[model samples]
Target: MNSAEFRAVFRYIQALLIITQASLVLTDHREMLPPSPADINWLMHEWTPTVVRETNYSHRAIIPARNSQTRAAIAKVTTCDASAALTAQFFTEVEPAVRWLRSIYVV
Candidate 1:
């Protein structure tokens, strides 16, 4: 998606979080194609920091990897960019993600 579309979706999620007083953002990226560079740049450099400054949102991205190399790469990228309030992680399964969100008391 383009920047406008991405921003619209993000804003929708923010509005939903504000209305429900929620803190967890569960993004299911299973079976989806890899993100474009623009998307990655916006999310890691822009959206994440914005969320960190504006809210206590913990983002859990469920991204199924095809192999160990992919998993390692995903882990490296996510862990390197994560923050205290923005607990970004890529989970291969939904159960573990649910458990983590619960552990954080944000589910």
Candidate 2:
């Protein structure tokens, strides 16, 4: 196959790997009857970027140790060239969830 085709296949495989790993992590965390502090912390800090090829959107969720830290990290990363759009989505959609998780866990 050509370079473009190979790249597309590689990206698809990468996306699938990311989704699978994220799902496993989420499921393992949920299986704990009462999630430990470490689990909560892991959930907040573990993030993977999945590029949605159909829409050309990259999606990621940041689980911060603190709400303010989340905001600051997002602010910092959003301005950088590599992750600007993903960071924007984090600010718009995922920020609230991150804050809520921080408040609930309060660690």
Which candidate gets the maximum TM-score versus the true structure? Answer: 1
Model 1 lDDT per residue over 1-107, tens place: 55577667767876777677677867655544445556655666676667666765666555566655444434444654545455565677888888877787824
Compared with the true structure, what per-residue lDDT tens digits does model 2 show for residues 1-107?
Answer: 44345345435645764555422110111111333334323223322223322233344443332345434433443354444444222223354645544443322
Clashes of each: 0, 1
Q: On a 0 to 1 TM-score scale, where does candidate 2 land against the true structure?
A: 0.25
Query: Which stretches of model 1 miss by more than 4 angstroms?
Result: 1-3, 59-61, 65-85
Task: Assess candidate 1 and give its TM-score to the true structure.
Answer: 0.64
Against the hidden true structure, what lDDT does model 1 obtain? 0.62
